[model samples]
Target: MSVPVEVIFKRPEALRDRPTHYCPGCPHGIAHRLVAEALDDLGLRERAVGVAPVGCSVLAYNYFNCDFQEAAHGRAPALATGIKRGRPDTIVFTYQGDGDLASIGMAEIIHAANRGEKITVVFINNAIYGMTGGQMAPTTLVGQKTTTSPYGRDPEQIGWPIRMAELLSTLVAPVYVTRQALYTPQLVRKARKALHTAFRLQAEGKGFTFVELLSSCPTGWGMTPVEALEWGKEKMMAYFPLGEFKKPEAEEGGKK
Candidate 1:
């Protein structure tokens, strides 16, 4: 008798079969897969609506299988707020990069989370602006070199990198906020578990949920994919510690 073959790995149905345009070694693909898998696991693919504003993540609409809305630069949270408010039954989320979320869209994201919108947010922090020619972003390391900060980011002149997870956790309205990384398989599994928690909490009509993913940008960082991943684990994780900054208390009242 012929040996039978078994399939152990396959793409999640929540993600389209099309190849992604992300650079070779980019962690955005990993993040996408995790989100898609979470949606599949939670049976929220059909009800999910993703908002991708201008940034490296702007193309997420084409990658995900569910409904997506393109928003202006730094305005994804605003768009997601409207979507969730208009259609309360649908699951809503935003995939935003550091440049899009921590820079120009800072106000929008802060206000949305402050208002306690029942939506999930996936923040991808690569430090440098990946889609816009390696410019320095709000989360750029203090001594990191970017096109905008050729000499290096100076804390005295521009201030230190922002800790988004820690900052958001300070807000009382948000129900859950966590920081995870995609540098290693073990970390990736943890990140996926966080994603599942965020999505599941959103489904339960919990208040604002945010998961900040420490992602790698090899092209922008001018490093090989392997080097970038290592760099992120060593340098990026040092600045943005990975953990649950905030979580809803047991039976705590969550805003709808």
Candidate 2:
């Protein structure tokens, strides 16, 4: 009895088949897959260029099957701007974390979005710093404990976590800005759609697309994989609500 089995899903050509170095249950892998799927769907893999800065995803170049440039901490947006401007035909993107982005890279990101650079940005905000030990980041929430803020983040002294999607949406030049998460299956599906939208807009030469993903860092958060997922869904989602903060307005072609 020879029965044939069909393959329903497979690895994206935009992603390498290498073993993952991410922690068990870390959402970085899921986020990677989503980005790869978007590139594959748009046939943009050949022209895609990714810029990765210091942080957990610093070694992102090793995982993705595309050209990657390494930039100094908080300088990804600046570097990406140059790359896109120089080679307007290529699809350039940056993969950054909260600490690398909202903290030191804050000015770089804001300015790039304001200028409407034709590039896509994938931001992974896990609240606390991930790669350089669990320290309080610009996106760390009040009462969240980290290595530096062992007593929990104090709003009086540290202030609140930055809502990047909302902040960037306020800018007039951006074509797309949205926040999504991977804590649940439904949310993960939505995140994939968001990624698709971001990449699709960039392919059409739309200026400045940003996708903020609420990622889970179990090791940094000091919780089991399951607990970290729950914390992201409950605490993180409450503060950084997921949805489109901005979208492209109708153009001459009736594109919205």
Report model 2's TM-score to 2 decimal places: 0.96
CA lDDT, candidate 1, residue 74: 90
Report residue 126 deviation for candidate 2 (angstroms): 0.3
Candidate 1 regions exceeding 4 Å error are 1-3, 251-256
Residue pairs with clashing backbones, model 2: none
Scored by lDDT, model 2 comes in at 0.93
Count clashes in each candidate, considering only residues at least 3 apart in sequence or on different chains: 0, 0
Clashes of 2: 0
Q: Write the per-residue lDDT of candidate 2 for residues 113-179, one digit (tens) a residue.
A: 9999999999999998888889999999899999999999999998888999999999999989989
Report the Cα RMSD per candidate: 2.6, 2.2
TM-score, prediction 1: 0.96
The lDDT values for all models are: 0.93, 0.93
